[model samples]
Target: MAKALIKYALTALLLCTGLAGAQAQESGSSAARKAVPKIQDGWLDVRAGEGQGRLPIHVSRDWSQAQPAVRRALIVVHGITRDDLLAGERAAAKVPSAADDAIIITPQFLIAEDVAAHQLPELTLRWGVDDWKAGFKAQAPAPLSAYAVMDAIFARLLDRQLFPNLQSIVLAGHSAGGQYLQRYALFGQGSALVDQAGVRLRYVVANPSSYAYANDLRPLAAGGFAAADASQCERVDRWPYSLSANLPAYARKPLDPAALMRRYLAHDVIYLLGEEDKDPHHPQLDKSCAGEAQGDSRLQRGRYYFAYAAQFPRDAAFKQRLFIVPGVAHNSTRMFGSSCGLAALFDEGRCTTEVAAP
Candidate 1:
């Protein structure tokens, strides 16, 4: 009788204890679900005194969340005087890397009134026509260059405390933005820092008005190239065309032409051009005497640049490749959404320039 009573009491005690533990587990899950902060997608108040007191960078909501297991980043820059369009890029990057968590960033460069109204410090970089694209130092107050802004951006990302598991970053631009990418890829000083930290970076230049030529000569209409005669376009052989003439104070270190060209050719870069951006009379086209020296339209300029690079230094093994988005004009949406664009933005899908223009 004593043994039977002891066995029955032990069985009842175990059942009650298990029931209480189950209730506690359910309560813990409920508390965990409530702990996640409610997030709304918008801009970030970049706490820095560099530009405009505090830079207002448009960021994707996903960036607020943890980087998905894939660990990738895509930074999309807007064209000159364009409204905030980072939300678009965020969606585009997401489309291709559905399985991967990619954080998309679009840093605003020219915030004029916002800074003025707020009485914030003047730190944003600006230039005439396309001078900023060449990466010159700001004239007054702060001596930072547009390329310096890119450096600061990477510094924030490379902070292991912030993005501990980041693997790769893609820097891309369209139109004037593309112009920035091409030059920065070749000569930007900040890239070495990221490389040292063991993070990979790729440049995607899309539909820019021109390319930085290694020499003073420009391509002719009848299938050949020649030097820019002083009597013709005097400034053609300077800065953007060739590393000649007096550059801004920012380029304190004189770069050897031969060494610079070789270094540029070695980086991983993609030249993405749109087939339908062939209008010679586009309102925003670079029609200065120097721009005309390159080619008549965006398409012509890109083709000539690629051809020039390919035949340089006795046909050096080039790492740069040119891609064209079919039937796409000077439109950002179509360019990034195309198969070629998707391939550049994300490491998935095949890209080609053989498609016919629609």
Candidate 2:
């Protein structure tokens, strides 16, 4: 009987020990997920207020030097993960032709936490993680809007001496990055610089959680859309969701909704939507009342925005198009690496253009 009791005690102790170990491992993983990401090495110096600020970036070529052979430039923005290096590498790989004649650049927009974690220099520009994606003002180095950093990057690319033969520029992003590009498409002033430089500019937006509607319209459940009821969702038309209010300093200018709509519809923008990105419960999916007002999922929101924009009065040269890529989800790799992605980014493959059903 004593031996039996000893054996039972041993078994209980063993079980407790195992449970403790498992809990410890889970705790470690949770800490790791919350840990700050490492900062990138390469930097681009730009004007921040009266002084200069530095931004991290990964470039396929030495953009500082003249690359006469370069005819196209692709700028791939990282999503919420801010994995700029990997994003740049994957983007360059998607276009094999980029090896010889095109340059790929990926810019990293770090947040305050990243700087504090890495003991970064004071001149390093940092923003609120979410605000940066929305073109909001950076928190450090200066109150410069994140979009201004983009403007500086565009100015650098337009240097006639560096890329003498540069004929086109493509700005591509996925997920949160897509949100950035979408809002930028509506309010960003970089296109004017690219236009003045006589370089054709295009935007590739994929799988953004939500879109910035030009007006107050929101998707309805049964079919079509109706202007959002302000009493039900007061913040529905706010900036980054729509052009109604709280526009970032970089994007805030005197303009009416109708004029903004005209500018947006005239721009050449392509959307890449994963057919399988319909999970309404995806953790990263925006489920706020404002977000829900758009649609239930990324796929639905994208289609609704595309169709909504189409209803606006556009010029004969309306340039926005949507491509729904089959068998992809909220993944940047699959969304940007698919045939539709390839065609949209590099004009290399075929993409089935999607039109809103009548």
Candidate 3:
């Protein structure tokens, strides 16, 4: 009887051990599934700046383990309401695996509320919005200065050693995000990543509502009311008039229209506009700054801006790459997918001869 009891006890112990091992294996698999996908080939989260905001940095390759033959990085900036992860995911989905050789970095900025709650007052005062002081006080602070946030992200990228073969850094932005990049590329000056890495930076302005131009508002040769010259007038002011007229005086403070034009002309910037986006009847068409300038229409102001830039000799080379994708609107996903063909242009290749008319 004693021998039989000992034998049963040993059998129960063996069963318990097997169950425990199975449970452990299941737990391990679950943990692996929960992990965030890496940025390039690996995604990890890092504090982008001093704020509570955490940016998900995705890497296509492990730069530490092995150096990639093509050392290129693309910095994608999200629009006003979106985050970096979504932007990166969208870009990754559209780009082919062959292009995966490049490292992609998507840095998220603090939300509007965070920014308004903490920094709005200071920004308002700095911009001399004393008249709107009471209104500003009621508003929240901004997350970070557009420039400061970008600088922090760039610093983090340099520290990561993720892109050992990093040669060129393409700054791509859409809509309001494009507006942010527009200002940053022009005024942010140079950073350590740019200087130390010998990074050649280029701007990809995709369907921005408005851009900071170095040119003044010039009236068409014929009055804006004439039918024969309607096309030229149509090109003159693509945004809604009300919003354009109501622009905060501070927004126009710099007043270097010609200089802004010259700067754009000299830069290697590409403007990607959607062809079907010329909807004057859209709900938001007449609202806000861009819409208000367009006589409340959703006409293609970005295209006009590209054409205007081409009129100048400095922008001749850039004018060749201006493109309008069919069957797309103010949608970033569609625009990115349509413009994927231009990926080669982003490489160390020469510009194509075909030019879209201004």
Candidate 4:
């Protein structure tokens, strides 16, 4: 009986040891899978206020082989419901792999399934009509705003001490991403963090759903309106409209066209619109915002904003440019890859086109 008991005990000990080995192996594998190359690609935690979350950042640079001063860094922001990894892959594929001096950083956002689930206060506050915070009190969590996430990413880049030879930083975004950057530029003015960075910030806004306010509508001269007639002056309201209602009562009441121009002039702002995106029935169209005051279509909205900017005091110095690319529609990869689309943002000579109100 003693011999049999000893045999059973030995077998049980061996079984336990085998299970322990398997668990250790599995844990090691998981760590290996998450461990990306620290040189070009890796994940870093971005501090959003006090909370922290991992933001995956992909970096590409080859300054060791190229002229130091020629090095340029670009941060690519993706649209809603889209992943930055996919966007970065598409962008990197289109550009020649031989371009060594440019460093592209595509940072991913913490967006989940529900759209309204993560509604940012900084954004909703712009549209005063809806108190989304109060209405969805239970759903509201201390989440990061689009701008906050951007700020965190920039801070992390500086902390990483990477891209030592970087000279310029371009903030490029498409569709909803463009919308976020537009507001970010306006809100970030004179902030100590951005001002001290010594980084030349330029914006490439591609086919955003909405745009900042230009100014109060002005009636075109009779000759100018002849083509469209009195209907041209008729007010139309549209979806994804400006946050006019949210403007503080004590704030600058009148919409100043010159001020708008001055804000845009501070940065290199370029708008790349898809010619095929003129469709009013496009699936992504924000019909409600477009239909409000001067409401017609996305094409018309773009024209109006462009014309209004032209009326600025420094209109000549701050000459605005817009690109209407053929055979593209509301897709960042398509817009950025097209000859006219990406060229419009990079090339000053080829990108410049007169903004004439239609």
Candidate 3 local Cα displacement, residue 331, angstroms: 1.7
Indicate the worst ten consecutive residues by lDDT in candidate 4: 127-136
Better of 1 and 3 by TM-score: 1
Error at 145, model 3, angstroms: 1.3
lDDT of 4: 0.46
TM-score for each model: 0.77, 0.87, 0.57, 0.62
- At residue 107, candidate 2 shows an lDDT of 86
Ranked by lDDT, top first? 2, 1, 4, 3
* lDDT score, candidate 3: 0.44
218-288 per-residue lDDT for model 4 (tens digits): 22322111011112222111112333334322123564544644766566666677776676555444343
Q: lDDT score of model 1?
A: 0.63
Q: Which parts of model 4 have CA positions greater than 4 angstroms off?
A: 1-44, 48-51, 61-70, 114-141, 157-160, 189-196, 214-240, 243-261, 289-295, 313-316, 344-349, 352-358
Please provide, for model 1 over 1-358, each residue's C-alpha lDDT reduced to its tens digit, 9 standing for 90 to 100. 5445443333322322323322321112232222112211333332223442224465553454444353677787666543435534644654746445667777655433334444545543333324456676544335456666677678767877667888888898887788777877767776888798999888888888767777775666666566665444545656665666655444547777657667777777777888999997675565555566677788888888877776667325676778888898887777877888888878667785633221
Instruction: Return the top candidate by lDDT.
Output: 2
lDDT of each candidate versus the true structure = 0.63, 0.76, 0.44, 0.46
**What CA RMSD would candidate 3 show?**
23.2
Best by TM-score: 2
Candidate 3: residue 136 Cα off by (Å)? 13
* Distance from true location, Cα of 131 in model 2, Å: 0.4
